[model samples]
Target: MRNREETYGLIVETAYKMFAENGFDKTSLAMIAKEVGISKPAIYYYFDSKEKLIDFLFDEICKEIMDQYAFTVEDLTVNNFEQYLLTIGFQMIEEQEKDVHFNKIFNEYILLATRKERYMKQLNKIQKGYFESFSMLMNHGVTIGAINQENVESKSNMLAMVIDNIGNFILTGLELDYKGIWKEAVKSVLLSVRND
Candidate 1:
């Protein structure tokens, strides 16, 4: 005798686990229904189609991570820009390690986004938000004389790439010194534009 909300939440949770472990390609409505102890039609009651479910998960992932890292440029000192990059990099690694299921689903969505218009819009909105934040931070750095204004957009793009991919180190469970590597990357990409 579950309410609609409980059943819907249960479906999402079960689907996330199944997709993360078995992959999205192999998962089917029948499989999800079997796992959730619901009929296939029951799943349709919550999600019209698999695509809609993926869309829902995409939003879920976006909301889950986008809520973090909300900081004003005024709160950040230009001198701490390198540490800022490190914080973003470390956060990615920590998050991926904390929930491999979430990380796997995120990667799957990234691949799907390439071919789906809806996913592209969602992904673009998320990335645009991050790009704007990085660009503004770099602009602030330049204003404070910590960095130059040259190539602000390109530099922001590079930093955003680093933040997005630094989580791979944890995904691979690599034993190398990732912090050392990230520090080198930050110095090369960002500190290279220092005004001083």
Candidate 2:
């Protein structure tokens, strides 16, 4: 009774659930079809293979990050650049907690990153985008003398590393005590930016 769009939605939704529950490698299309109460052939009508399903999910997660970037940086300018980064970090942690796929993804990708270079490329792209955004913000800050003009690349890379490390920690179920860890980490990163 479902339309093609509905069937595709069901397939994606079902696969997402299974992937979250058992991770990408453990989850199978047959299991997803069973979970959706559909035949494997029927499921294939929507998703031809598990890799295709994962590809779709990967894009979906990347889109979520891209979408959040808009809201997180909407009103950000040179004056409040630090606050902008902090806001985005905290918001991302909260959003990652709400979505099981996000958490599963961190675990899955980190565990298999070396063996999965193509998928890892997606992760790299997202991280680089984050860095570029921060670099632009830092450049603006320098223009206004709020931040240093020298060593922009180094400063941006360090900031990006801090954020990436934080995300990795959170994904590992490490209690960051954000208020404590973030303040110190931010200060250190800013010191590098200001050093220039």
Candidate 3:
């Protein structure tokens, strides 16, 4: 079972790299199998089809991001909101820097989601989950006198949008200093909701 899990992870990672380099439409299951040093049947044993693999990859990435968010906001407080935002922003920047191919593949998935109804549905569902989590955090802040009780829903939505856009910008290879820009953007959001 452990080996199966490891092989599954390897196949997903290799397929993402190939997709990043050659694109999803251009990448084939045989190529992924070859890259992972596995037989085509082995690959099929794990994933029924390329589309299933893509969906699995998307879900896995979403789970990881959500897990990170949960950890980041575990001890949420108004005083620490800025620090937390900065921490997450920098962490995302570092992640993108660590593997340009992953960023490219993620960006490509975003683009593909826009053109495909099924992919777009999945993306939207994930985004809605993010918005809900952010909204809950802001509502908690309001209850604790950390944030002003003014349009918490809208404020959360705005914050989520800003964060998502910053990520998209970074993934698309923006030339500016994204870390600095993200800090400023997060600061702005925090200031906008401060109880003071």
Query: What TM-score would each prediction reach against the true structure?
Result: 0.78, 0.78, 0.78
Which regions in candidate 1 have their CA more than 4 angstroms from the true location? 1-3, 189-195
Query: Residue by residue across 1-196, what tens digits does model 1's lDDT show?
Result: 9889988999999989888878889998789989988899889999989877877887888897676545466656666766776776677666766787876777788888788888788878888888887777778777776666777778777877776666765666677766676677667656656534
lDDT against the true structure, per candidate, is 0.76, 0.71, 0.77
Q: Can you tell me which runs of candidate 2 are displaced by over 4 Å?
A: 1-7, 68-78, 110-113, 189-196
Residue 130, model 1: lDDT of 81
Best by lDDT: 3
In the predicted model 3, the residue pairs found to clash are: none
Candidate 2 residue-wise lDDT, 31-146, digit = tens: 99988878888887777888888888878877877666553334556568777667666776666656646676656665666788887788788877877877776676666565
> How good is model 1 by TM-score?
0.78
lDDT of 2: 0.71
Q: Judging by lDDT, tell me the better candidate of 1 and 3.
A: 3
> Which order, best to worst by lDDT?
3, 1, 2
